[model samples]
Structure formats: structure tokens, C-alpha cells
Target chain A: MSVLVYTENWDGVFKKLSFELVSYAAKVAEMMETSVTAVSIGDVADDELAKLGNYGAAKVVKVDGNTTLDNQVYTGIIAQLAEAEGAKVVVISHNNTGKALAPRLSVKLKAAVGAGLIALPSSTEPFTVSKKVFSGKAFANVVLKTDVKILTLAQNSFEVIEVGGTATVEASTATAGEAKTTVKDVQKQTGKILLNDAEIVVSGGRGLKSGDNWGIIEELAEVLGAATACSRPVSDEGWRPHEEHTGQTGKIIAPNLYFAAGISGAIQHMAGISSSKCIVAINNDADAPVFESSDYGIVGDALKVLPALTEAIKEAKNK
Target chain B: MKIVVCLGNVPDTTTKVKFGDGTAFDKTGVQWIINPWDELALTRAMELKEDAGNPVSSVTVVTVGGKDAEPTMRKALAIGADDAIRVDTDARDAYAVAGQLAEAIKDKGFDIILTGIESSDYNGSMVGGMLAEMLDVPSVSAVSGLTISGSDVEITRDIDGGKEQVSVATPLVATVQKGIAKEARIAAMRGIMMARKKPLAVVPAAEVETLTDFVSFELPAPKPPCKMVDADNVAELVDLLQNEAKVL
Candidate 1:
């Protein structure tokens, strides 16, 4: 049996997410004393296919198609591949696509699943997977008991390693049933990184005073090459787009760094960003709950703190 | 058109989370409420039913929980759901829960099923997808906007770097998130009074094999107090981030 990893490639290029999944799959495969097989549904170039090997994939299968990510079809194809390869463990990312397809695949394969998995199984014997729950405030160690197990790794939780190797690449195709959902339109955001994909995020809140006063926050984010986010109140007040909001009622993100300016950390807001690797808060109130959660705190007007911090970051980058 | 909005009973969002048993969630002194996202989904379903065309014939709410989950179901009925169904059981796992739901609702002939993207407690966002698979239907994930036009069900979902507007027929599932409705609907006094009269069917849960189980839980460690950085020496903050945190 093999460990199968669903490596998502966009426009024939694999991103950090794919490598992470492959890396995770390789480790899980090692635990099970099996080989790793990577699967890509859409068009991925030969050179790009080899990259999966660097992360320990022994074999990579490129399913040639002009893929339009239909969850059912994808599930069918993956399930078929798993059966053909005699896969005992399957790895997928706990993102939008995986969110929709993993369960279907689990049901189809009659395999147990642990979604939002943060770490490798604490015990491979029982196949216990550690995952974040309660909005990252707590951790749950879930055990998958079935012979076949499915795991959707949480984003940014696992590091991508170049474990020096190469994978055998092959081309194949399979027929899945018709697609019921039609993608009518897709509007891509430009000029900024998406919050979900960002490594560093700079956010503002009600303390920013007004929508027009967001120049400092933007300037800092631009200097850091990071995405800009806002609190729920900022979005509700129309200071920022609803898409930029980060809180319990808004987007939940886990970036490498979360920089908050002029925001009092509400419990709801904290729930969204508590998973960030490092957090720095800039607020005039020293006692703001944000300070309690942040690694670094600057008690001052965000309007001034932001610009100075931005200039400093720019200077540091140059040096 | 008929709709079934799956409701998950969770502790109030404001409630401080505590673990009673090692792996089981603590429920003592906690107020149970309909999950926020499910409430919003129900509100949107209510709006669709009350639309001018009245294209929607009925709205039903379903849950996989024990007797403690009934109050939350009643709240959904008060929020305008036509009826409620409780699969009397604990939500042991997403796969088992979905199996129970599919067994209970397969012959019910509901055209559309809506579920929150995830629950606030466990946040296991797998049930909706499993529902679609179990019933052999399509599902839209990360759904931000859901609307009905004639017979078409329009669903807008949040993708990685963009938004995709998709359309699908009924017998589909849409896992809902924020922006499905402007605000959660508040039940009026009359709605509450009538909700008491609404029918709540309690069905026995299917004896499905549990695939996953929680072995243990651990609360996150307390973060150290923030290192104070003077606003005047903002450059020092950068130095600390670089040398100390190594995040720069």
C-alpha cells in the first residue's frame, strides 16, 4: 500500500502548500513503512512534477485535464487512484477544495478522517492526529480507527522540507461522473496577497480613527510585502471591505506574523488570529487585551507608530 | 422548494471554554445556543422562503445531538423554520453524524440542504461535505452568498485569492459562511409563542460505526507578557523582531 497525497497545482506550478502536503505524506508513509505517491489532477509541467520528489514523494501521477475543480469529480478520481495504488493513508490540505472533497472521499472510501490536522500522529499505532479546535484556543488529539485513514493538514502548520530526492513522473487520465455545479464567474483579487495565503499580515481596527487614516497601515503592509486585514468593526463601518475583516464573524487566518495596529483585541478577534506564529500589537492603551496576547507591544497612537514602524521595516529590509 | 438547515448546538460564543473531561468539552454552566453560522444560514433560508415569489415551500432544521440540543432547535423554529428534527445522539464524528443525517433525511425529499461552514466548538467542517456525498448530491464550500432565482441556486464561495460564483440545481448542499445574510434574524414575541406549537420530530440515530474519536485535549500554553517597546525607538522594535524573535 502507498501513502497518497493530493498535491494541488495551479497553472502548472506547485506552491508551498503542495510541498507541505507531500512532506506530510512522506512522513506518514514512513510511519506506515510505505511509499509516497503524489497526485495532481490538472495540467502540471514535467519540471514542476519533479519538485514533489524533493519533498520525498516517490512517485507522482499527473492527471491531465483542463481541470475546473468539481469536488465530486475530484473525489471520484482521487478515490479511484487510492484504490489502484492500494493507498492506506491519504493526505489533503484543509483549504477550500479539501474542505469540500475530503469528507466525500472519506465516505466513498469508508475511511476515517481527521480534518485541520496540525501535527503528525502522536501515535501511529492508534493513528492519533493532533488538530486545532475551539478556534485554535485548544487542541484535540483525534484517533482514526479505520484501515484507511484521511488527513487534511491545516495550512502553514507543517514546514516544507527539501529532503533531497527525485520522483518518477507519469501521465494518466480517468473519467469521473458529470459535474453538477457550474462556475459562472471568478473574480480574482489583485495588487495584494490573500489573507489565507499571506505569511505576514498587518491589520487595523476601530482605533485607526477613520477610513481615510488607513494610509499608515497600508504603507506598513506594503513595506513588509504582507496582506492587509481589519477587525470586524472596521469592516462593518465600511472602513475596509468585508473580505479584509479578520475575526470570529469574519475570516480566520494563520500567518507566520500577525501585526495589529490600533486594534483592541476582542476575544472574538483573538479567536481568528490566535494561531499566528508571532503577533505584535500597537495600541495607545498599554492595558489593551491585545498586549496580553502579543509578543511585542508599543503603547502609542497607531497613526504615528505605524509610519515609524513602516520606515524602520523599510530601512531594515534595505540593510 | 424545501430546505433543511443543519443546526449544531454549541456553547455561546462568549462563554469561556473549559474542559470538564480530558477530551470531552465542558458543558456545566454553559448556555447552549445555535451555532452562529447556522443561525445565519437559517436566517438566509427564512429570507428566501419569505421572498416575494415564495419559491420556497418549507424550511426544516435538523441536528445530531441528544436532548440537550432541543432548545437550540426550538430557537431555529422561532427564527422561522417550519419544523425541527433531532437525531437523538451525540455528534460522535463527522462521518457518523452525516450517516445518521442521510439515513434520517434521505426519503424526506428536501431539495436544498444548508450547513454552517464549521461549528464554533469543534470546528469540524466535514459534515456538510459528507452530507453531499452520502445523499449523492453537489456541495458548495466556503459559501459567502446564497440566493435563489427562478429554479437556479446561486452560490458565491470564497476561494484562495478570489471569489467564484457558481450555480447548481436543487438536491445540493451549500456550506454557508458569513455574508449569507446581513444579520441573524431575531424572533419576535409572536414567533416565540408560535414556536412552542411547532412540531419537533425526534428520530432515533442510525447505528453507524464511528470512524474518529477524540483521545485527549490540551489547552494552549499561556503566552509571556508582551515586551514593551517604546514608540520613540520604533527602530529597536525591528531589531528585536530580527535578533530576538527572528521573524524579520
Candidate 2:
């Protein structure tokens, strides 16, 4: 009859998505008339787990283990916790870690699970959950009739709320499963925004003509403190790294503000970014498909439009 | 090495989305196809098999969908999968799908399991990770490059801002991301002709766990009309972004 929320961390620090999930779980806990306990696994520090209390978690459960990104080990631990706590509902963030853990925990607990959830459960007979479908092209409502329910909320789907309070931290020990995998090294990208977590994104397309002329795009991104992205053709042409590509065939992203400069929006590209809150397009072709999806459309040469936009951003920030 | 690529039949990315009276999707008139991410996973699996000089004995494609998904399942066969398995069910929930897949493959003795990072339709991106957990194996997600040497697999994943490289033992699961490999080759006329002869198996979905349920579906609010700012009005555009949108 209790609710358990998985508090996600990265390199020992809590991620923003953790707070967002906790905020979301708090609401569900309130509606269900149950207390919410936030759980963190694998070497999380005491002070860090304590921060969960501010987000409405009544208590924080910290399980210490030398953990890698192994789903089996994490799931085993979560299953034990859920069973021990007699949790009726488990809330997790639909990020990399949650995506890996939620389904396994559901299987182990014999609980129903829903992923890509966008909002709190509707207060209806079946208690349906809303989720994004078709790469943000559509929506689907899922109802969980089981006594135990597992829900993985989409990242950035719910607004982060702050309810100032202190969380009680409790240390719990669990059996550690031997990892079948070995991690020899961890190489991380330097000086790049995590594309998924970026608030502002500046993307380019084939209209930039070549890789050498990417300075304008980078400058604009820099001025706006935004992440950089590109269209499929731009990546295929080797004008940008494949990781920078954002489209249906590439990475799908939904940022607060997306500036698509020099790219024609193909259906595939639109499919990936159509969920972005605000879209601005800068292209010479007035009929470009990107214009159709953009909140604001500027019909002009990108080479000219980009520099102007960058300068404008810099000036506005300074003022 | 034996690799299993889990596939899901999903609505085409371009299909118009409509929700029924409840939260479940209205499937009428929606064209179904193999999820695009899963296609990337299958293509990568096939590539790894080829690069290993056919060290891979079998490439199995697994799906949890209804009989209507057989054509899409057959397409995997055309793309070089040796065999296919369709768990007879239309369970769209990730947990149920993972349970069915884990049950079918748990005893299959697979060394590697590959799946798309997320399905284009559900965008759940949960099964691969869950399956690995249920099978008690290590799992990496959003892997862009994978190389196998003996029992160890080296994977490179795109993390926030940068990439992470991990080396794990065999019997591992990986969710493949785009840009990990070249575009998947479409079935050639000859390949298509031969796919009809490939072995396709159907099995009832496992009854393991039930968690969430769909209540109804709702379309996102229609987008507002585009407001064009004259190219000369750059300042006004900036003002709107800063004041109106409050996103600047």
C-alpha cells in the first residue's frame, strides 16, 4: 500500500530527472493516500540521498553497492526492496537507467509496468496513464489493473517542483549479484551538453553546405548556451559527427526551444523534434517543410540569418 | 556467437495519431511496420555477424505482436535473420513485452541480445534493459558502436554531452542507437524471394506480470499557426522570444 520512487544518480550526484520523478511521484502518492519512499542504489552518499526529502519523499532508502550500468543487479535489489516495503506502486524516471530497470523490476515483482509516461495517472475507474507514442507523433493511455503498478515517467515530461523539507535517510543492505560484464574503462565526452537534457538546441542541415562552415552554427549555440544538432543529410555528408544528428533516423529530442537553422525539415526530422515546445526555422526556401513545423519562420539565407541571430542573442543577454 | 534481436511491430512514424475514448491508441487505419530503432539493432547484429566471418551461428528476431505482424517479421528474415519468433499477443506495455521476450529466450542460450534503443511507436525504450535484468545479464543502452573479441564485447554509448565506453562479458544485452551503423539495406528482390523460405515460428506470449493498463488516448493540442517575423524585424523576433516565450 506504499509507493516507492527510484531516485536516479550520476557519478554519485543526483540528476535533475530524479527530482522531476520525485515531484511526480509525490502527486501520485498524495492521490493514492500513501507515503512515498525514495530509493537510491550503488554508492550514493548520505547527504545526496537526503535531498530527496525536499521533493516530497518522506524517507530515502540508500543501498550501497559497487554498481555499473548493469540492469540485472539493479533489478534484483529493487525487487527485494519493493517486496520488503510492501509497495503497491513503483515510480521511476524514463531515462537510461529507469528504462533498463523498470521492466525487469516489473517482471520480478509480477507488477504491471508502463514506460514513456507523460503525466500523473488520471483519476478514473481504470486509472489510466498517458504516454508518448510513435516517437512523439501520438499518445496512448495505459491502464494498470494489477495491485502492484510500475510507472516510468518520461524525462522533462513533468515540471520540477520544490517543496522544502528534509528527508530521513535509512541505510539498507542487499545481496550483490556478480556482474557478468567487466568495465575496463569509462570514456566520457568533454564540454558537450547531454543532448537529451539540453534546454535550448541549435540544429543545422544540408543548407549549411559543408562541414567547414559549421562555425556559424557553433557560434549561435555558444551565444545561446545551447546544444548543437544536425539533420540526417548533414550527418550523412560528414559535415557533422553522427551523434550531432537529430531526426527520426537519428536521435529524437524534445527541448524547450529548438532553433533549426539551415535545415529543411523532412518528415523524419520533424518526427523527432515535433515535441519541442518552441521551434524556430531559418532557411532561404520559404516552402521548406521545417517552416511548417516552426513556431517562427524566417525566409532567408542561413549564412546571413545565423550570424544575425547569434549577434542578437549576445546583445540581448548583455543588455 | 548467437545474437537475438527483439523487434516490435509499431505504427509508422508518419501515421496520424488518434486516441480512442480511453487512453489506448486507436489503431484503425494505422500502417504497422518494424520499429525503426529495432531495424538499426537488426542491421547491427547482421553486420557484427558478417564481420565475425560468420562466427555467428544464428540471428533470431523476436516480436510480441499479433498475427498481422508476420509480414514485418518476415522482413527481418529477408534482411538476413536466420529465424524469427512471434509471441502471439498485442501487449504494448513494456513490462509485458519484456516478460514474453525473456521467457522465450531465457533458455535459448544466446550470447548477445540486441534491440533498438526505443521503439518509434511506444518510445518506451524499456525491453532491452528489462530483458537483461530478467535474464540476469549486464546491459548497455544507446550503444553506437560494438566490437566483439572472444567473450568480451566493447560498446561505445552516447551519453549526455559525450560518449562512454564499456567492456562487458558475453550474454549481455545492448540497445542499439542510430549512427551506430550505416543505413540498413533494404531487402533485395532475391533476398525478398528467399525470405519466404526462411523459418518463422509463432509462440504464445508468456503470462508473467501485469502492471499498468491503458485507459484512453488523447492527441496533443494542435499547434498554433506559425507567426512570420519579417527578416528585417530581427529585434522584434528576439523580443518575442525573450518576452512572449520567456525561453530566451
Candidate 3:
């Protein structure tokens, strides 16, 4: 038996998220007294595939020739690999692609699935794992009883371990299934870091007054090298794209650092970001609910405070 | 074409979650509403049915909850579902929930099935995909945009770095998120009165093996009060971030 992990790559290269999954799988394999077999489907380069070994992948199953992710086709491939390898536990990341594929895999393999898992399993016998539930407002320990276990690691939850090793690479014997969907078009977001992958984020809210004044939020984000986000109303008011909205009804993010400028700490907004490690708030109202959750607060008009904060960060970074 | 949009009657977004029987969600005095994501899906279903160009015939909303959930189901009809189905049991996990739904929806020949990406409660994010696998049909996930065209549906799903558009045949499951609709449509007074006459079927939950039992629930630790800083001392905030928070 082996621990099989599905690692995702972008443009023939792997990112921190993939490495983190392999790292998590490696530990699970060790706990189960087995080895880790990592699978890469699509256009990941040879050298890039070798990096999985650094995180304790004992073998790499490379499936070539797919440029884009077709969820059903990929699901068929991963499900077949797990059955052939006798995967005791199948590991994957809890990102968008994983969300689309993991549950399908669980059904095909008859495995119990734990999505958005935050840490290593507390026990391997019952296969108890912890995952984020209730939009990060709380956590629950789940017991997976099926013989084959499947887990999707919550992004950035586990540390990437670099253990010296080399993995045997093999070409996948599984072929693609019949495609049921046709790709119509693609619109890739350019420039800034994607919110789900960002480590730090700077956000604004309705308190910012106008969309044109968003230059201050951007300036601060530039100084901090953070992604820009906003509350639902800010996006609703057309001050920012809906993509930037972070709330219960919007995107739920858990970056290491989150800066909320002029955003009130509403329960909806807080549900999306309460998992953030450090939250800093800047607003004119000293009694705003945001202060109750923020690690630090500056009671001032965001329009004025944002520019000043940006300049201070620039000066501090230069020093 | 008939559409079945699944609804999750969960605690309101702003409700403070408190545990009741150690791990069970405390519902006392907590106002429940259709899950935000599911509400959006219902809104889109209504829009599709209302549009003159679309082939949508009827829209049905289904939920896996007990009798108390009927009020929430009535609200779904008020929001514009043609009918509602209640599974008549509080499911143990997503796996069982999907099985119960499959039992209720199978052989019904619904052309399209809609589910939210994740419920605000539990946030399991699995029912739609598992239901599709059980029914042996194709499915799309994290769908931001969906439109029916010539007996086929074009879907826009979120991928890393950007968006991807794909088209799938009917009798498929599609899990959607925000951007599918501008905002959830509230019930008008007329719609509310009409909902009173709508049919709500409460069927028994199917017996399915439950997976992943929850051992316990723990609320996150609340952060200490924010340290107030002077606007003039912006540099101090930067210093604290770098030295104290160590997140720089």
C-alpha cells in the first residue's frame, strides 16, 4: 500500500501549494508506514517533476499532453492511479481544481473524503483528520471509516518540508477518458497575485468613499507587496471588481496578514477572514466592530491614513 | 427543461455559532436562511425560467432537513422555486446527504441540477459532486457563470490565475458560486402569497452509510482587543508588523 498525492502545476512549474501537499502526504505516508507516490497530469516539465522528491515523494507518475484542466478527464485518471497503486490515503490540495475533482475521486474509489483538512491526522487507525468548517468560524475533527482514505489539504495549512531524496519517475499507463465538456474560452487574470495563493492582503471597504480614491489602497498594497481586496459593498458599489470581494458571500481567504482599511468588521466579512493570522484595521470609527477582531487599529479617516501608512511602509522597507 | 436547485437552510451569515450537544450546532434563537450560495443559485434558476429565450420549464428547490425546515423551504418557493422537497431528516454528513438527495431526485429526469460551491454551515463542499457520481452524470464545479443554449449549457468555472469556460450536456450537476447572479432576488408580496399554495413534498431520508463522523467542534479563539495607535505613528504600526507580528 502507498500514499498517493495529486500535485497541481501551473505552466509546467509547481508552486508552494503543490509542494505543501506533497509535504503533507509524505508525513501521512510515514505515519502509515508506507511510501508517497505523487501524480502530475498535464504539462509539468521533467526537472519540475523531480522537485516532488525533495518533499518525500518516492515515485512520480507523469501524465503528459494536457494543457488545461478538464475536471472529469482528470478525475478518471487520478481514480485509476489510486486503484492501481493501492493508495491507502489519497492526498490533494483544497483549491478550486481539487474541489472539482476530489469528491468524484472519493465516489469512484469508495473512499471517505475530508476536504479542507487543516492538519495531520490525529490518529491513523480511525483516520481522524481536522478540517475547517462553518467558513473558518470553527473547526471539526472528522473520522473517515472507509478502507481507502482521501484528504484535500487546506492551502497554506501545512509547512513545506524539504527532505533530501530522489524519486523514480514513470510514465502513466492510464489514458484520458472521453471528454464531455468543450472549452469555449479562457480569461486569465493578469499581473497581481491570486487571492487564494497570496500570503498577505490589503483591503478596502465602503468607507473609502469613491472608486477613484482606490489609488491609496493600491499604493499601500504596492509598498507591502500584497494582493488588493475589498468588502462586498465596495465591490457592489463598483469601486472594485467582484473578484476582490472577501466576505461570507464572496471569497473566503486565510492569508498570513490581512489589512482592512475602512472596512467595518461585520460578521459576514469576518467569517471570510477570521482565519487570517494577523488583521490590522484602519477606520475613522474607534468603536467599529472591526477593532474587536483586529490585532492593531488606527482610528483615522482611511482616505488620509492609507497614504500615510503607505509612505511609512516605504520608508521602513528602505531602511 | 426542469431545474432542481438544492438549498441548505443554515444559520444566517451573521449568527454567532455556539455548540449545543458538544458538536452539534446550537440553533436556539438563531435565525435560519437559505444558504447564501444556494440562494444565488435559486435566483439564477428563477432568472433562467423567467427569461423568454430560455427553455426552462420548472424550478424546484430541495433540502435535507427536518420539519422545522419547511418555513425555509416555503421562503425558497417565495423567492421563485416552483416546488420544494424536504428530505425529512437532518443528514449526518455530506455523503449521506448526497445519497438522500439522489434517492429523491433520481428518475425525475431533471435536466439540470444546481448546488452551491459550499454551504455557509459545515462548508463540506461535496454533495453536488458526489450526487453526480452517484447518478452517473457529468458535473461542473466552482461555476461562476452558466447559460443554457440549444439543449446544452455553457459554464464558466474559476481556475488558478483566471477563468475557464466549458460546455456540458443536460442532465448534469453544476456547483456554482458568486457571479452567477448579480444578487439574490428577494420575495415580493405577491410571490409570498403565491408560495402559500406551492407544493412542498417531505420524503423520508434514504438509508446510506455515513462517512466521516464529527468527533467534536471548537470555536476559534477570539483575538485580543486591538492596540490603538496614533495616526501620526504610522511607522510604529509598520515596526510592529515586522518585528512583533513577524509577517513582513
Specify the highest-TM-score model's number: 3
Error of 2 at A83 (Å): 2.7
lDDT of 1 at A230: 98
Q: Candidate 3's residue-wise lDDT over B11-41, tens digit each?
A: 8887778887667777899898999899999
In the range A1-319, model 3's lDDT, one tens digit per residue, is 9999999888889999999999999999999999999999987777889889999999999999766576678888998899899998999888888888888888888888988887899999878987777787788888999999999887877889999888888998687677787888989888988888889999999889999989998888887788999999888887788788998878878899999999988988987888788999999998899999899899999999999988888898898
10 residues in a row with least lDDT, candidate 3 chain B: B16-25
Q: After superposition, how far is residue A75 of candidate 2 from its true place, in Å?
A: 1.4
What value does the lDDT take at residue A280 in candidate 3? 93
lDDT of each: 0.89, 0.81, 0.89
User: Per-residue lDDT for A256-288 in model 1, tens only?
Assistant: 899989899988899889888899999998889
Q: What is the interface RMSD of candidate 2, in Å?
A: 2.1
**Each model's DockQ?**
0.80, 0.63, 0.80
Q: Indicate whether candidate 2 or candidate 3 has the larger DockQ.
A: 3
lDDT of 2: 0.81
* Candidate 2 chain A lDDT trough over 10 residues, lowest sum: A175-184
Error of 1 at A159 (Å): 0.8
Least well predicted 10-residue stretch by lDDT in candidate 1 chain A: A62-71
